[model samples]
Structures are given as structure tokens and as C-alpha cells.
Target: MAYEFTKEDLKEIEKLKTKYPEVTPVTLPALWIAQNRFGHVNPEVQKLVAKTLDLPEAHVHGVATFYTQYYKEEKGKHVLDVCTCLSCQLCGGYDILNYLEDKLGIKKGETTDDGMFTLNEVECLGACGYAPMLQVTNDKYVNHLTEEKVDNLIESLKNGEQPEYEKIGMPRRNNIK
Candidate 1:
């Protein structure tokens, strides 16, 4: 399908352009604006962003392709990013992924039939301490996952309620003094 940025999005992109010295710097924010408006920065959206920013389509395509967070294609309402990086892997990351797959009836990288959730097996979210964690819609991190917690999360999301997770401050850096 075709995609076009709204006037408000264009205004936001215009504001972002002023914050950067070169168009290169604005690519990220411009892509973000397009993604937020269109739900994914597909090829069409990338072309739109490039045309709007007066940059080459190849440059926009390169940036969009480099980041998995950009969502090259459309995704469900909720994208569950399960981390399978080192810490998470050793701590049953695949187990959590399986549980979610079974619970949602959709494997990793696939969305449910209802289009409510899309399961993704992502690399680390930089939350090693919180191994076996998954991010909800690229926003909230649900860490130290368990089957029951996953169940509750699904239910909460299904019911249109944001699950409340406890705040976890990062461990103190030893060299910081």
C-alpha cells in the first residue's frame, strides 16, 4: 500500500531538521516520524522520508535496513521483543520465547491471527541483569519473565491495560566514583 506523511508529521520533521546541521543527522528522526505515523517505515515510507528530506532513497533505505527497530514491514499493534542475547539466553530466554509462542499460538517473527501481538526474537536490550526480558511495543521492558507473568501480561494487554512492572535501577558502575 501507499504511505504519505501527515502535515503534523511533516511539521515534526521540519523541527527535527533544524536540530541537525546536515540532512544525514535528520534521517533517524525523520524515519522515526514516518514510522510513528505509518506504523512501519516500509520501502514506500522510506521513499517518502527520503523525498521529504531531499535525500537519496538509497541513503534512507540503508539507515532503515540497518535498524531492526525500524520495522521494515508492517507489525501488529503490540510487538513483543524477546531478548535472546548472552545473558538472556543462558537464563532461559528460549524457554520464555517458547512459552509465548505456545501462549499466543504464533512463533517468533510472526503475528497472531487477530493482529494484536507480533512475536520477535531480538538481541539483548542491554538489560543483562534482567535476563529473560521482553519489551512491550518497544517501550516497556518486562524482565525476568516466567510463564505466569507472561500469561498475566497477555491478559492485561488483551484487556487494554498496561501491566505495571517494578522500576529497576541499573547497577552502580564501579569506576564512576
Candidate 2:
């Protein structure tokens, strides 16, 4: 409880502790909140969480690094994740990723000079039909891309134009369809 966390955060931590009788049960959620606040897991955060829970920093680091969702460094506002799964590769995901790199002048795991975009290669995004896809933020996944399409997608994103994704999967509902 003597961590560098804010007052509100401490309250939330107290609630979590109340909910979970064990310290280990609260580790993942606490790490997620800490990372959201700091943009990444750092040595300071690991130590703070570990000491607060009477755990080891190395254990905390192991959990943080094991998950791809936990970023290790500061990321750009928009994360461009290119699919590199087998389906996507067969459909030219590699070329699409190369195009993104060349266009942004940054390789995979690198951010743009303007801090607007970060390029990364990820596993299947569940859009195999739209293989060779790139996800911008959590919204857009421009698929079946050509060079012109990629350029257009980037420009539209820069212009704050949110494209509609039709002809793909539907959102799940509790009730039957």
C-alpha cells in the first residue's frame, strides 16, 4: 500500500484486494491498471507491485513480459498491427507490412518520428477472408489491400475518417439470432 500509486488508484487496489482474498489473484488486474497509467511496465512498477503484494519483482516481470498485450515501451496513439499469419502471408501480408515500413520509414516494433503510428506484426486477427489485413487502433482493419488502398487508408486515418467495416463478422449478442 506504500506504493507510488495515486489516491484513487489505491482505492481501486483496496477494492481489488477485498474482492480477491489472495494477493496473487489481484496481480494481473493490478498490473493492467498500472500499465494503463504508465503506458508500459517498468522496473519501478514491477518493484512497487511486488513489494505491495509481498511477491518478487522477477515474478512480476515474467508475467508482464509473457503477455504481448503489455507494452514494454511507450506506444504511439495509433498502433498499426499487420497480420503475419499463414493465411495473411499467403495473401501478401509480408508485402503489406513492408509497404507500411517503407511508407512510415519505420520497421516492425518501431514508432514513427511524429509519434502518430507504431507498426507491429501480429498473429491472425480473425479476418482470414480479409487476409493481408492491418488493424489501426481497435477499429479499422483494411483488408485485401493494394498499395493505393494502403495509402488511402493511412490518409483517411490521418484525416480522422473512420471507415465502415461491412461484409464481415457480426457482433455477438446474448440472445440467439
Candidate 3:
């Protein structure tokens, strides 16, 4: 089926466009809006975003593909992005990744059959000081991980629980002003 944005999405995009002088600059935010609503940026959604912003489809494709944050395919309910940077690697990041794979029965970049979780080995999550950390669905960070903690986290999530996690890095600057 051909994807199209909702009326509410269009309104949000219009508001976002006002922040920038040109429509081209709204590409990233528009793409983010699509991802936020759809959980991923598939080809149909990419085309929708491109048309909405009046940019070429190829440009949208390039921007989406260039960034790891943009998922071109469908993702699971909870996206687990494990940090594999140098600091994290030295602190048992690979071990944690392997453990998650074994526990979830899916390899990195693959979603579980139940669609509960997707694993991704991502670069620096900006919490190098707190090695062995991961981001959950771009919302929360779990740090100083271990097998026991992983088991507990999975069980909690399976029970439809939103477990609270500590933030590992400094706060991000979402606005210039």
C-alpha cells in the first residue's frame, strides 16, 4: 500500500518548517516525525516525506541511509542500541551484545520473531565513561550492565512494564536558544 502522512502529521510538519527558512532544512525533522509515528522509515514513508518537503526522493533516501538513527525497515517494539565504541568494547560490550542475542534468539540488526525487541550494535552513545551501556528505544539508557540485569530488563519489558533507567551521558541540546 502507498504510505501517506496523516492530517496531524502535516500540521506538525508545517509547524516544524516555520523553524527553518527553507523547506529543505526540514528534511531531518520531517523524517523523524515519520519514524516516530511509524516506528521506521520505509520506502513509502520516505517518498511521502520527500513529497511533503518538496525535495527529491533520492535526497531523502540519501539522508535516511546515511544516518543510523533512521530505520529504513520496520523495527520491533523495543530497539536496543548497544554501544560498541572503544570504551564500551573494552568494558564487555560485546559480551552484553552476545548475551542479548542468545537470550532473544536473534542476531544483531534482526528483530525477534515476536516483534518485542530489535538489536543494533551502535557506535558511541556518548557515555564512554559509563562503558557497557545501551539505549532503549532512543528513550532511556541502561548502564553498567550484566547478565542478571539483562534478564530482569527482558522480563520486565515482557510483562508490559516500562522500567526506569538512569541516563548515562550529559543532556543533549535540543534547541540553540
CA lDDT, candidate 3, residue 147: 92
Candidate 1, residues 17-131, lDDT tens digits: the string is 8888987889998988888888899999999999999999999999999988899988998899999999999999999999999989999999999999999999879998988
- Candidate 3, residue 4: lDDT: 76
Q: Give the residue spans of candidate 3 off by over 4 A.
A: 167-177
Summarize candidate 2's per-residue lDDT along 1-177 as a digit string, tens digits. Answer: 323777777778778988876778777878877876666667678777777667888888888788766676778767888999999999999999999999999999999989888999998888888888888764577888788988988887788776567476667899987
Clashes of 2: 0
Q: Which scores better on lDDT, 2 or 3?
A: 3
Each model's TM-score, in the order given? 0.93, 0.75, 0.90
RMSD of 3: 5.5
lDDT of 3: 0.91
* Models ranked on TM-score: 1, 3, 2
Write down the TM-score for model 1.
0.93
Q: Give the winner by TM-score.
A: 1
Task: Report the C-alpha lDDT of model 3 over 1-177, residue by residue, as the tens digit.
Answer: 667788999999999989987888899999999999888898889999999999999999999999888899999999999999999999999999999999999999999999999999999999888889898887788888899988988898889886695754676898968
